[model samples]
Target chain A: MRIAFAGNPNSGKTTMYNALTGRSEKVGNWGGVTVGSKEYPIKEEYTGGKEVVAVDLPGAYSMSPFTPEEGITSEYVRTANPDAIVNIVDATNLSRSLFFTTQLLELGIPVVVALNKSDINEKEGTKIDVKKLSEKLKCPVFETTSTEGKGLKDVISNAIELVGGGQSAPYVQADINLQNKAEVDAEDRKRFSFVNDIVANVEKREMLSSETTKSDKLDGVLTNPIAGILVFAAVMWAVFWVSQAWLGPLVADWLVGWIETFQEWVAGKLENSPAILSALLADGIVGGVGAVVGFLPLVMVMYFLIALLEDCGYMARVSAVMDPIFKRVGLSGKSVIPVVIGTGCGIPAIMACRTIRDERERRATSMLATFIPCGAKIPVIALFAGAFFAGAGWVSTLSYFFGLLLIFLGALLIKYITGYKYRKSFFIMELPKWKMPSLKFAFKSMMERAKAYIIKAATIILICNTVVQIMQTFDWHFNVVEEGAENTSILASIASPFAILLIPLGFGVWQLAAAAITGFIAKENVVGTLAVVYGLTAFIDVDELEMTGGANNVAMATGLTSVTALAYLFFNLYTPPCFAAIGAMNSEMKSRAWLWGAIGLQLGTGYTVAFLIHQFGTLFTEGHFGNAFIPGLIAVAIMATAVILIGRKTRAHFDEKYRLHRDGKSGAAA
Target chain B: MLLNAEPGKTYTVKEINTDDEEMNSFLFRLGCYVGEPITLISKKKKSCIVAIKDGRYNLDELLSSAIIV
Candidate 1:
C-alpha cells in the first residue's frame, strides 16, 4: 500500500516522511524545498511488518497548480490513485489549508489530516478542537509535531486502518461548469466559506496572525531594505570564515594525521609486494581518496551552518531582502535561494529553481547559480590559497566575491542575449514564523552529508584515482614509462593538446591540464589528481611543508606562480559544472537551447576571466604581458564579437515580432 | 490602493486588477479576493508585506498595486 504525504509548503511533510521512512530528504523552512516527489518503504517500526510505501510529494496550495512543482503534487494525487492521503496541514493556518483539504476529500480518497505544527499553535495560546474538526471534515485528524515525531504513530496507525475504506466528504461543490473561470471562482468562494465556518467553530486564538508580534519586530531589522543586505553579507562571511579559516582546518588537521598514518600502514604492509603494487594501492588509491576526504570537515561544517539557517526560517527573508536587487538582473529574489544552495552543491540548487514561477527567470538562475563555488570546489580553493597565498583568508573571500561578480555579469549578458523586456513580474513568498534553529537537526543533516561524502570517496573518487594512476603510469605500448620520461605517457599526450589552449590563462602544463580535464567528472578530482601527480600526501599540512622546504617542492612540481595559480583556480571555479550538475541543468531548464547556451556562457566566462586575470597580473608584476598574449587577445575578441553579433540579431528579431504585435493592436483599434 | 495603504490597518479586498489570469487565481486561492479582510502588516518602497487568512506574505509593488483595497 502507498500512503501519499501531501500538503502546503513548509508544513513539515518531508520531516514526517523522513521519520517514517528513515530517509534524509532535504527539508527547509522556506516553501518549495522539495521540488520533486520521492518514495521509500515505511520503516518496520511504523509499518508493523506490513509492506507499505510512503510517497512524499511536493507541496501545493490548491488543486490548481501555480508553479511547476505544485503541478507535480496535484497531478500525482489526481492520477496515481494512492490507497490513502496523509494531508499534512499546518494547524496554525487551518483556514487556508483546509481549502485544499476539502478538494482532496471530493476525490473520495481517504485522507487523515496530519495537523502539523500544533506545537507552535499551542505556544501561541491558540486552541483547536481536533475532534470537532475531524467530525466536520469527516476524516481522522491527528495533531502532530513532525519535527519532534510526536503523534506520528497515531497518524500512521489511523491512516493504515483507513486504507481501502470509504471517505465521505462533508461539504461538496454543487455541479457546475468547471471550465468556466467565473463558475470556478464562485465555487472556490463557497468552498472557502465552508472552511471558514468550520474554523470559526473549532478554533480559538488569543493572538491573531495579523497583530504585531515579536517575530515581526525581528523581521523589521532582518528584512529591512538596506540593513538586511548588510546582515546577509555578514552572515555569509561568518559562515565562510568559521568553516574555511577557523574551525574547518583544526578538524581537518587531525583527520589528515589519521589518513597519513593509514597510508604508511598500507605501505609497510605491502613492502614485499611489487614496487608498482605499493604505489598503486597505498599511494594512488589511499592517498588520492584520502586527500579528497580530508576536506570533509570543511564541507560538513558548512552544511551544519546552512542547515541551521534553513531550519530557522531566515531563508525566506534572505530571498525577500535580495528580491529587488535580483529583479534588476531579470531574476527574482527567489533566485537567491538557489544561489545560496549552490554554495553547498549545484544539483539541488538547480532543482530549487523549480519554485520560481517565471520560466526565463528560472532558467537564468540555474545557468548562473553554479558560479557560486560549491562544496567540492572548496578543496581546490583551500589548496591554492594555502600553497600560493600562505593561507590568507582573503583568497577564499575574494573567490566568492569574484563569483558573485561573474553571476551578475552572466545574468546581464543573458538578459540582453535573450532580449527579454520588462514584463509584469510579481513576487510573493509566505513568511514562516521565526524560531530557534534546531541544533540536533543541523547535526543530523551534517552527519548525513558526511556519510554521502565518504561513500563518494570510496566509490567514484576511488575508481577515478586508480584509473588516473594507471594511465599516468604506462605508455600506449602498455610498458611503464621510464623515469624522467613521464611526458610520453598516454595521459600526458592526450592532455597536451588541451594544455596548448590554456597557455593564455597561465599554468598550461599537461599535468595541470589533466587535472582540469578530470575536474569535469568531479570538482574534488582537481585536488585529488594534483595530490596523486605531485606525490604530496597532505596539502592541508602547509605550515609543516613551509618548515620542511616542501612548499617550494610543491611549487616546483606544479610550476605555477601566484598569479597563474589564482587564474587556474578561477578557471576551474567558473567553468561548466560537473556532469551531474549539467544533467540537473538539462532537467530543470528542459530546453536544449537554454542548456547549450548556458554551457557556452560558462565556458566563455571562465576563459575570459582567467585570461584577463593572468595577463593583467603578469603585466603589473613583471611589466609585460603573459605568454601567448596575442593569441589570447584574439580568442577573447572573437568571443566578444560573437556576443555582440548575437545580441544585435536577437534585438532585431524581438523588434520585428513586437512591431508586428503593435501593428496588429493599432490595426484593430482603427 | 494597496501600495499606498497605511500599515497595520485592515481593509477589504475591493478587486484584483491584473492581466495575468494565473497570478490572479493564485492569489485568490490564498484567500486574497474580493471581500476578504487583508491587512497591510508593513510597507516598503518597492514591496509590502500583507496578511491574508492567517498567513503573512511579502508582495512586490507591481502585485500589491493590482490588489485594490
Candidate 2:
C-alpha cells in the first residue's frame, strides 16, 4: 500500500509518520530539506502480504506552489498516485488547514483527515466536527493526537480500508475550471471564494476570542518601531544562546572524543607505511576533510534546532515581526533567511538563495551570505578562544557578532551601490502557524543536512586534500631542502605568495598563512593542513601535550594572543567564502566577467576591512592608533554613508534624478 | 485617481473597498489575495516597502508601478 502524509508546517505530519514507522527510518538528502519528501516503509505483521511505503512530504498550507515545499508536496499528491493520502491538519487551526484540504480534494483522491494537535485544540477551546467535515468532503476523517499517541489505530485502519477503494473526497471542482483556460477561463479567478464558503459552514467559532488574539496584542508592541527592535534583539540573544551555550560545546566535546578514537585507530593501521598511511589517513582523507567532518555532530545539532523552529513556523513569525527594520535596509523580512542560515554554511545558505528570485536582492543576499561565518570556519574562532582568549565564551560570541555586524554593513553597501536601479524586486510572503516541532522532523532534517555536508566533504574536500598532499610531496624550491625538513617542505613552497597577503591580518607566519590560503578551497582543510605541516597527528597526543620546538605543541601552534587570534577569526569570517561560493557566483550570475567582478568585490571588501583592522587595531593593544588606520575608518564611514543614502533611495521607488534618467530613454522616443 | 498615489508619498492600506473594479479583479486573480492589504512602507529613489497582509515586501519601481494601489 502506498500512502502519503501531506500537510503544512506544524501540522504533525512528521510526528504522525514517526509514530507509524518508529525506528525503521531511512532518510536521504531531499534537495536541501525545506521542501524534500522523506519516504519510509511499514511492514504489516498479521497480513504478511504487502509492505506499505508511506512518504512524509514537507508541510505547506496551500497547494499554490508558492514555496518549494508547496511545489514538492502538491506535485507528489497529483502525480505519485498514492493509494491514500492522510492530509494532517492542526485541529486548532482548522479554518486555515481546511484551505489545503479543499485543494487536496481537488486532486481527485480520498484524503483521510488526520486531525493532529487535538490535545492543544481542546485547551484552546476549539471544536472540530470531523464527521461533518468528512461528510462535507465525502471521505473519512479521524482526530489524532500524534504527540500523545491518540487515535493512530483508527486513522491507519481507515487509511488501509480506503486504499484501492477508489473513493473521491467531497471537494467542489470549479464548475467552470477555465473551460478553455485561455478565453473567459476567468472564473478560475475566484481563488478563495471556496475557502470563504467552506469556513463559513465549518467554523464553530465565528470571531477570534480575546485570548486567541494574543498574537495581535503582542504584535502591536512587538512590531512597533521601538518595541519590535527590542524584541528582535531578544530573539537574536535566544538564537545565540541556543546555538552556542545549549548545543555547540557539548556536541563539540562528544565529537572530539569520537574523532580521537578514529585518529588513534588510523594511526595504528598506518604506522609502518608513512607515505601510504599519511596519504590515506592524514592528508588524503582526515587531514583534508576529516577534521571538518568531525564537527558534523555539532553542525547537525545546529541544523536540527533550526529545522525544528522552521517546521513549527517560529522563524516566519520572526520575519513578520521584523518587517519594519528590513524595510529600512531595503530588504523584506524574509531576506533574513540567508543571513540566519548563512551563519551555518555559506554553501547551503547560498543554495537557499533559490527561495529568493529577485536578481538584485539575490545578489545582495549572496554578498551578505559571505559575511556570516559558517560552521567550517567556526573552528578558527573556537581555536582562538581556547588557546589564547582563556576559552572565554564571550570572546567567541564577539566573533559571531563581528560577522553579523559586517553582514549588516555589507547589506547597506550593496544597497548603496546597486540601488537595484535597473532591475525590479518584490516580496510577497506567507506566515505559518506556530506549534511544537517534532523530534522526528528535527532528526530527519538534521540527517538530511548532514548528508549534504558528508557528500561535500567526500568529494570536493577529499579532492582538495589529495591535491595538497600530491603537490607538497614535490619540492617547489628545486629540492634544495631535504624531504622531511621542518620549515622547508613542499607545502611551504606553494604557500609563499598568500603568506604575504596575511601579513596585514597579523600572524601571517608561514603555517598559519598557508592554512588560510588552503582554506579558500574548503575551510575545513585548515586543521588537516596544520596537522600535516606541524606533524601533530602522530607525534604528539592531546593527552601528553609533550614538548615540541622549545614549547608545548599546543602552545607553539597557539602562540598568538587572543586579540590577534580574534583578528584572524574576524578576517577569515569576513573573507571571501570557499571556492564553492565562487562557483555559486558563476552559476548565479552566469557571466564570467560578473563572477570575476564578484570575486573582486569579495576580495576587496575582505582585504579592505581586515587591512583597516590590522593597520589601526594596534591602538587597542598599545593605546596609540596608527596613521594607516585613519583611511580605513574613512572607508568604513564613506561606505556607511553611501548605504544610508542608498537605503533611502531603495526604500523610495524611483526618485526624480534617476527617474529622469529612466524616462530620458523614452524622451528620445517622444 | 489611485488613492495615495503621490509621486513621493507612501501610505499603509487602512480600508480597501472591495468595490474598486480594476484593483479587486487584479488581486482576486492573484488568488484570494484581498485579505492581505499592503502598506506603502517607504518610497526611496526607485524602490518601495509594501507591507502585504502579515509580510513586508520590497518592490522596485517597475513592479510597484503594476500594483494599482
Candidate 3:
C-alpha cells in the first residue's frame, strides 16, 4: 500500500514523512523545500510489519496549483491512486489549514489528519478539540510533533488501518460549471466559509494571530531594507570565512596530513614494482584522489552552516529582504536561495529554481545561479591563490565580488535577450515562526553531502586523473615520453589547437588548455588535472607549500604570470558548470532553446571576462596589451554582435505580438 | 486602502483589485478574499507584512496596494 502525505506549504508534511520513512529529504523551515515527490518504504516499526510505501509530496494549498512544485503535489494525488493519504495540518493555523483539509476530504481517499506542530499550540495556550474536529471532518485527527518524532506511530498506524476505506466529506460543493470563473469563485467562497465555521466551533485561541509577537519584533530589524541587506552580507561573509579561511582550513590541514601519510604508505609498498606501475597506482590514484578529498572538511563545514540557516526560518526573511533588489534585475527574492545554494553545489541550486512561480524567472535563475563559484571550484581558486599570489585573501574575495557583479549583469542581459517587459511580478512569502536551529539535523545534512562529495571524488576525479596521467606519460607512438619531450605527448597535441585560441587571454600553454577542457566534466578536474599533468601533489597543504617555497616552484612550473593566473581562474569559474549541472539546467529549463542559449551565454561570458582581465591587467602592469590582442578583440566583438542581434530579434517578435493584440487581431504568438 | 492601513489593526478585505485572475485566485486560497478579515502586522517602504487567518506573509508594495481593505 502506498500512502501519500500532503498539506499546505510549511505544514510539516515532509517532516512527518521523514520521521516515518527514516529518510532525510531536505526538510527546511520554509515553503517548497521538497520540490519533487519522493517515496520510500515506511519503517517496519511504524507499519506493524505491513508492506507500506510512504510518498512525500510537495506541499500545496489546494487542488489548483500555483507554482510548478505545487503542481507536482496536486497532480500526483489526483492521478495516483494511493491507498491512503496523511494530511499533515499545521495545528497553530487550524483556520487556514482546514481549508485544505476540506478539499482533501472531498477526494474520497481516506485521509488521517496529523495536526503537526501541536507543541507550539500547547505553549501558546491554543486548544483544539481533536475528537470534535475529527467528528466534524469525518476523519481521524492525531496531534503530532514531527521534529521530535512524537505521535508519529499513532498517525502511521491509523493511516495503515484506514487504507482501502472510504472518506465522507462533511460539506460538499454543489455542482457548478467548472469552466465559468464566477461559478468556481462562488464555490470556493462557500468552501472557505465552511472551513471557517468548523474552525470557529472546535478551536479556541488565547491570543489572536494578528497581534505582534517576538518573531515579528525580530523581523523588523532583520527584514528592514537597509539593515537586512547589511545583515545578509555579514552572515554570508561569516559563512565563507569560517569555512574557507578560519575553521575550515584548520580542519583541512589535519585531514591533509593524514592523506599524505597514506600516500607515502602506498608509495613505499609499491617501491619494488615497475616505475610506471608505482606512478599509476600511488600518484595517479591515491595522490590525485587525496588532493581532492583533502578539501572535504571545508565543504562539509559550509553545508552544516547552510543547513542550520535553512532550518531556522530565516531563509524566508532573507528572500523578502532581497526581493526588491533582485526584482530590479529581472529576478526575485526566490532567486537568492538558488544562488546561495549554488555556492555549495550547482546541481541542487538549479533544482531549487522550481519554487519560482514565473517560468521566465525560474529559467533565468537556473542559468545564472552557477555564476556564483561552487564548492567544486574552491580547489581551483585555492590553487591559483596559493601558486600565484602568496595565498592572498583578496584573491578569493575579489572572485566572489566579481561573481556577484556578473550575476547582475547576466540577469540584465537575459532580460534583454528574452524581451521581458515590465510585468507586475508579485512577491509574497509566508513568514514561518523562528526556532532554534537543530544541531543534529544540521549534522545529518552535513554527513549526507559529505558522502556525495567522497563518491564524486572516488569516481569522476579518480578516472580523469588517471586518464590525464596516462596521456602525459606516453607519446603518440606508445613509448613513454622522455623528460623535456612532453610537448610531443597525446595530451599536449590535442590541447595545442585550443591553446592557440586562448593565446589572446595569456597562458596559452597546452597543459593549461587541457585543464580547462577537463573542467567542463567537473570543476574539480581543473585542480586534479593540473596536479596530474604538473606532477604537483600538495595543492591542499597551503601552509606547507608556503613554508618550503613550493608555491614559487609551482608558479614557475605553470609558466604563468600573476595577471594571467587570475584570468585563468576566472575562465574556469564563469564557464558552464559540469555536464551533470547542465543536465540539471536542462531539466529545470525544459526548453532546448533556453538550454543551448544558457550554455552559449556562459561560454561567451567566460571568454569575454578572461580576455578583458588579461588584456587590461597586462596593459596596467606591463604597459602593453597581452599577446594576440587583435584576435581577442575580434572574438569579443563577434560575441557582442550576436547578443545585440538576438536581443533585437526578440524585441521585434514581442512588438509584433502586442501590435496584433492592439489592432484586435488574434494574438496567436503565445 | 491596505497600503495606508494602520499596523496591528484588522480590517475586512473589500476586494482584490488586480487584473491578473491567477494572482487573485492564488490570494483567495490563502483566505485573503472579499469580506475576509486581514491584519496589517507591519509596514515597510517597499513591502508590508500582513496576517490572514493564522499565517503571516510579506507582500511587496505592488501586491499590498492591490488589496482594498
Q: Which of candidates 1 and 3 reaches a greater DockQ? A: 3
- Interface RMSD of every predicted model, in angstroms: 0.8, 8.7, 0.7
Per-residue lDDT of candidate 2, residues A531-609 (tens digit) = 5555443211223222333123534654565455656666666778888877775665556644654565566667666
Clashing pairs in model 1? none
lDDT, model 3, position A8: 93
Question: Which numbered prediction scores highest in DockQ against the true structure?
Answer: 3
| Alpha carbon lDDT at A614, candidate 1 | 100
Global lDDT of model 1: 0.89
User: What CAPRI-style quality would you assign to candidate 2?
Assistant: incorrect
Q: Which pairs clash in the backbone of model 3? A: none
Candidate 1 lDDT by residue in tens digits, A1-670 = 9999999988899999998998999999988999999999998787778888999999999999999999999999999999999999999899999999998998898999999999999999999999999999999999999888899988888888999996899888899998899998898899999989999999999999889777777776777889999999999898888888778877887888899889999999999999889989998999999989988998999999999999999999999988898888889989999988998899999999999999989999999999999999998997887778876677888888788888888888888887876578899999998868999889999999899888988888888888888888899998998899999988899899999999999978888998898898999999888877777767776344232343455566798999999999999999999999999999999999889989989999999999999999999999999999999999999999988888788777777777697874322110
Misplaced by over 4 Å in model 3 are: A542-548, A661-670
Q: Model 3: number of clashes?
A: 0
